[model samples]
Target: MPATGFDNTIEVVAVVVVVVVVVVVVVVVVVVVAVGVDVHVVVALVVVIVAAVVVVIVVVVVVVVVVVVVPLVVVVEALVVSNGLWYYPHL
Candidate 1:
């Protein structure tokens, strides 16, 4: 894959994360203001949402590392080896 494609994928992932966080925040605020939910309930809801967001972020990071960074690294390593750029000295 091209570098531009990787850049686009990263941008898309970032946008998705931002959108998810913003939507969660909006929903929580709307529920508090319009529904007048109990304070404890709101707090619990926020906790759950936060945990979910954290999980999402972790998953995305792992995916990007595995899918994008790892492949890129392997490609670069292969290129270096093929070009005889890597150096070794007898010890």
Candidate 2:
């Protein structure tokens, strides 16, 4: 039995095809990395915005509690004391 040999044209075509496939894969990977970086930046910006909103809300709540509720309580206590409602019965 005689051995069959591989064609030279086929060998060259195979090499070219392999190189093209590798180049396409590298391009795709680079594009994916760029998109991922963009996504990360957007997410970071959103997180910062959300944190700022939360801080503002907390400050407003603290201000209202300290400035409004405390004064109201003090006024109510004063009125009660002035009306003889908190008198002691010690002789």
Candidate 3:
């Protein structure tokens, strides 16, 4: 016996439907994993932790500039120059 044209078309359609379903499942799984936590959580824990780290670094830099570096610079400038003129007569 030989296959007819209609049978060939039905087989192609079935294959296409299966491929589409598989692709959809894969996409959904990838999205879920990328989120790193459940969808119900309003804020992802991973994102919150990263933001916290950034805030800590910014605070440390601000504290260092105010407490240690700014005073050092002011003292050095006062000792080295006065009235916008170099204190030493010769370079």
Candidate 4:
């Protein structure tokens, strides 16, 4: 079926709005994760985990000390410590 000009415009606008909303959501999530944990450690694991390490790697964030002790290695280098935080170990 042939679409009208008004329909096309609405479709384009809808696409644009969806794209913008997705971008904003991604940025907000990233910012929140970054601020909550250490960016460096998160980069290693590719996710935020309150910046903790295995065998008692405690990192102070804000006014709290987040301790990490990875018990299981789900992925190749991903470590899941306490407090539901996961991170990667240093080489």
Candidate 5:
């Protein structure tokens, strides 16, 4: 077996992130169930799930912005530059 370099690395990364998030969500659900249903615990689990989802969304958004926006900004800058048409926006 051999690995190939990803051309659309951001898409690949997003896919991986989605898979991981699904797995983690499932695991968290199972843990919540196994621990016995309690209102507080269920609430906590919901919060955890929501938080995980938010984090994943944020990660995907940031990656996408970097992948798509950065290049567009660069090209636009090359074509025509504003005061700050293209600059690395640090996280």
Candidate 6:
């Protein structure tokens, strides 16, 4: 069986939630470490964590757009074109 849009959305939401939870845990850990660590070390660690988080977010967005959004648009376009409900200018 093929996966539906709802399944895809659920998967995406799960991934985002997991990422958020991880970020929160890491932030908490960093805060705890900052009290005992040097300021420069804490800053560097934070920079690295932020960069990693940004990269993860970018990857998730790209995957959602390409894997989910683009295919959904194509499927809807095909359906519309087949039913003669709308003109598909590209084709």
Which candidate leads in lDDT?
1
TM-score of 1: 0.56
Give the local distance difference test score of model 2.
0.60
Model 2 lDDT-worst window of ten? 1-10
Residue-level lDDT of model 3, residues 19-64, one tens digit each, is 6556555655665577655663324444544555565566556556
Whichever of 1 and 4 has more TM-score, that candidate is: 1
Q: Considering TM-score, where higher is better, how would the candidates rank from best to worst? A: 5, 1, 6, 2, 3, 4
Q: What digit string (tens of lDDT, one per residue) describes model 4 on residues 1-91?
A: 5442233544554565566556555755767677675665346444323222221121123112111222123232343344346553642
**Alpha-carbon RMSD, candidate 5:** 7.5
Encode model 1's per-residue lDDT on 1-91: one tens digit a residue: 5674455666777777787778777777777777687886678677869876796878688777867798899899878877889964531
Pairwise lDDT winner, candidates 1 and 2: 1
**Residue pairs in collision within model 1:** none
Q: By TM-score, how accurate is candidate 5?
A: 0.57
Q: List the residue pairs that clash in candidate 4.
A: none
Q: What is the Cα root-mean-square deviation between model 4 and the actual structure?
A: 23.1
Predicted structure 3, TM vs. truth? 0.45
Expressed as tens digits, the lDDT of each residue in 49-73 for candidate 5 is 7887787887778777877887787
**What local lDDT does model 1 show for residue 6?**
55
Across 1-88, the per-residue lDDT of candidate 2 in tens digits comes to 4332322434544565566556555655665567665776566556655655565566556556655687688788778888988874
- Tell me how far the alpha carbon of residue 75 in candidate 5 is from the true structure, in angstroms, after superposition: 0.5
**TM-score for each candidate, following the candidate numbering:** 0.56, 0.52, 0.45, 0.33, 0.57, 0.56
Model 5, C-alpha of 62: deviation from truth (Å): 0.9
lDDT of all the models against the reference? 0.75, 0.60, 0.57, 0.41, 0.72, 0.74
